[model samples]
Target: MIITTAGRSPSKLVMKAKKLSTSYGLSYKERGGVSIESLKEQYQDDIVVVGKERLYIAPLYDESNLFFHPNLAMIRAKRMFKGDEDPLISTAKLTEGMSFLDCTLGLASDSIITSIAVGSSGSVMGVEGNPLLYLLAKEGLSSFSSGNHLFDQAMRRIEVFHSDHLSLLQQTKSDSFDVVYFDPMFHSTIDSSSGMNSIRGQAVKSELTKEVIKEAMRVARERVVLKDHWKSDRFAQFGFTQHKRKTSLFHYGTIELN
Candidate 1:
């Protein structure tokens, strides 16, 4: 992919884009308001540099602008701390000082929330199979801020890696983390899955296997968590205790290790 700046691009931004391109082994071009064909000519694909940390997927379709931030996840986490219940925390039994490994960090929303719940003492590691998604989440988590201390700290605490979950799980030591989590793409898409369209094209489309769950069990100290559609058979297939709140479209399942 090629890196370029916006119409009002400045020297600092241009330099940043060039640096990022070099670091990622991608080509760099200087242009603004360029045609889609022009972007395809040099970079093959375009990754626009917006702001110091923001990057948008071009040709925005149906309001599916792809950018990364810890806003959604951190908001949910704050609410959860205020006596509100979140499916992720309830399912994983998350608490302060608990370590977690997010095997499928699509947009890193869940991972960010986990970091918040775990606080400063705990650690969170996220793995993304797609290089593009990893770059987006990793950079955003490190650089973006929501003007909220908890949000910023949560974002900074996440350690994201670009790799497949299965291999990472296999390489992890036994009970390395308090919780192991997965949120793979669904077999069918739903409207409630907001902002997912932008990621579907680049997300890992693999179905979770029994062996994967086995490895997760080995790596988790408290439980292995899975988030999926309520109707999905993955919970049963993977031997999780399924939980679905009233009127909730999604399901949270967990296999307790202790």
Candidate 2:
């Protein structure tokens, strides 16, 4: 949900955010010249980015915590990919000369990883529907660049847009991407005890319908990787042949197009 805080200028917004942060037990930090707070209250899930315009937060599925914990990417890599340094970097197949389109660029983790994999020779375009998440991911990517090898690659290779995935896909040329990746948010009525509880309240509990998958397929030249919960049937209904990799809380399924 988008929450617009009252303020006309960045300074005013920063002031308001400072006040809000104090209420939520979080300290205020300056990001992009704006004072921001990661709101863990009001919304129980997803990282909150409070800006002058609005506070954007996406909900996390209960299972999402298993695969997407902020610090577990490397751990997941060791288990899922058999000691590969980072699964996202490999799952993306982001070689030096290939282009990638991350359709559901949620946390932008995939985009960041792919950007590094592609190096300076290729580009990674990430589209995120939520403005708050986009801003946070952008900032996070910026911070990550300080010590990461992909610092230069991310600067040169990654481009982010705030827009719906469907509309974004339509604007791309056919076969424009060597890989089109999706990590669509899935719906859940019953909450699980997995690590995702912190972000479950903010997650968008709707799966990407078959129509969306078809569009992703249409744009991808090489393959489409659809990350899903173990229980979801959306992938099967969309006619994707699955290759599964088990993680702590969810599975990574790849659907190769004909």
Candidate 3:
């Protein structure tokens, strides 16, 4: 993917893009004439830009431009911090001073909440199989501001990697983390789930096979959690004991270790 600034823009942004291009091994281009339509015609492929504060482009799935936003993740984290329970916290059974791994980082909403639940002394590692999604989420987690310092702090603490979770799990030592989690994108979702549409293009469309659970169990000291559609058969198929909440579209399947 090529990185470009907004509106054929600033030297500061150009310098920043140059730095990112070098670090990320992406080509940097000048947005001459500031036309995405022209640029798409010029490059003959999908195009996204490193806009002033976020990455944005016309959504592959929708008419609007899609940009990164912590969205409800931040809200839920704030509520959890103020004493309400969160499904992610509940499924992972997180507590202070724990370590957690998020195997499917996606938009990183769950990882952000996991970070908040684990607190300052704890650590959260997020793995993403998609490089573009990784770059977008990693940059968002580091630089996006929500007008809330604590939420932003939690975001900053999350360490995201661009790698397949399976490989990472294989290399991980048993009992290395308090929890290992997955929230793989469902095969399909209801139409109103427009928020995730942008991510669908770059997400790893992998099935959570029994082998995934086995590796997660080995690496986790306490639990391995999978959040999937309530109707999904993965829980029964993979032997994850299921827990469902009233009126929730998703259910948490968990395996607790000794």
Local distance difference test values of all predictions, in order: 0.77, 0.58, 0.78
What is the C-alpha lDDT profile of model 3 across 66-97, one tens digit per residue? Answer: 55677778678778868899977877789989
Task: State, as a TM-score between 0 and 1, how close model 3 is to the true structure.
Answer: 0.91
- The local distance difference test score of model 1 is 0.77
- Cα deviation at 175, candidate 3, in Å, is 1.6
Residue pairs with clashing backbones, model 2? 45-199, 46-199, 58-202, 59-202, 59-203, 60-203
Top lDDT model: 3
RMSD of 1: 3.0
Candidate 2 residue lDDT tens string, 1-258: 222233244677677667656644444545543222333343444444454434443333332322222233333433533535555556555577788888777666556567656767787888877544565555445434334343434643578787788888878778888888887763232234343354444444435767777788889988888766767786687765555666534455666665
TM-score of predicted model 2? 0.61
Cα lDDT tens digits for candidate 1, 1-258: 556776677888888888888776767777767854566554546455555547755522224445665556766867975889776886788899999999988668888888888899999999988766777887788888677777788888999888889988888899899999988853233224444455566566656999999999999999999988789899898899898777877878899888
Q: Which stretches of candidate 3 lie over 4 Å from their true place?
A: 58-63, 186-202
Between which residue pairs do clashes occur in model 1?
none
Off by over 4 Å in 1: 41-43, 59-64, 186-199
Lowest summed-lDDT stretch of 10 residues in model 1? 186-195
At residue 235, give the lDDT of candidate 3.
82
